[model samples]
Target: VLKGVVYISLSDNMLYKSGSYEMSDQAGETLNKIAKIIKDYSNYDVLIEGNTDNVPITSKNIRNNWDLSALRASSVVQTLQNKYGVDPKRLTAGGRGEYNPIADNSTEAGKIKNRRTQIIITPKLDQFMDLIGKAPEKS
Candidate 1:
């Protein structure tokens, strides 16, 4: 059983076209599954983080890896909020550019693996206050 929350990593190829932030048609099914899971757990907040390979991006729209990664993350966030109706307050988007890689960037396969997104589901801390125990009131 999950102790607190679930974490899912989605490859960029599964969500967006190469070098573009536009969500692909296949992304719909994936997002749908995520939405159902999020709906079941109202006490958790979702963090969507986008990552990129170390290769330099020189596209007209995507100036650098930072912009590419950030826009990708924001695109996913928008889809979740607008298409799936997830609570805006419970979602956050982050971009890691090419700085945090789970695989070596020397190989094509590894680079492919590095270009991905991570969805982190964490339980809200409000319910943990009792477990943490409150401080004594100031006298």
Candidate 2:
């Protein structure tokens, strides 16, 4: 469980080819696992968030690393809904892009690690309540 919500992380290596939204063959098993979990926990909602390195994209198809990241996230969402029969309403896709870097961009290894996507599974309960409950009350 994470952030008061059940989640499973799906990295880029296990997901797509470098700079592409296409799912890799290695991703099949991991994705299948998520699908199975979704089936088991039908009430849970899946939120797919994508991230990327500092390397800016300049391609016509990819305006910047952000677009690439979002494309990847969207692809995963589509796969889950289309292949696993997960309800479309139960899934969401978004991209943080390079705006939110997990590692230093100076090194190739760090960049690789930063260029990844994550899936956060959350229940329908109001998440904001967790924060409000944890706050320190003042007179």
Candidate 3:
């Protein structure tokens, strides 16, 4: 957890097969556990962010890392809503592609680290918005 937000990073290998957005059976089990936690925390919103290594990719369906990343995130979000019964309004899906690298992409280990899906859970914005509304304006 960081700054009141919980970050759960799942490696690409855990969620998908090589170069594909299709979630594995193991991914379903993992997501089932995550869904339980999400249900336990009703006031938090989930952000599914997908990241990829710097390696270029071209497949029958996926054109590039950006497309792959977005598709991966969307897959997770859809599963969470449709399969796990998470509220659709509480989820957001995004792709970082190769831009936001937590590790150097020059090494195999780094590339492995770069290929990940981050599930960021944060409290809803209602309290924050209320705080902002109550703040006094300066001249």
The sequence of per-residue lDDT tens digits that candidate 3 reaches over residues 1-139 is: 7756789999999989888999987899999999988888788899999999999987987988999999999999999999999999999999999999999999999999999999999878985576567878998
RMSD values, in order shown: 4.6, 2.8, 3.1
Assess candidate 1 and give its lDDT. Answer: 0.89
True lDDT of residue 127, candidate 1:
56
The digit string of per-residue lDDT tens for model 1 on 72-118 reads 99999999999999998999999999999999999999999999999
lDDT of 2 by residue, 1-88 (tens): 8555676765688888766888998887888888898777677778999988898776678888778988999999999988878899
Among these predictions, the greatest TM-score belongs to: 3
- Let me know the TM-score candidate 3 reaches against the reference structure: 0.90
**Residue 138, candidate 2: alpha-carbon lDDT:** 100
How high is the lDDT of residue 37 in model 1?
A: 89
lDDT of 3 at 113: 98
* Alpha-carbon deviation at 130 in model 2, angstroms: 8.8
Better of 1 and 3 by lDDT: 3
Tell me how far the alpha carbon of residue 138 in candidate 1 is from the true structure, in angstroms, after superposition. 30
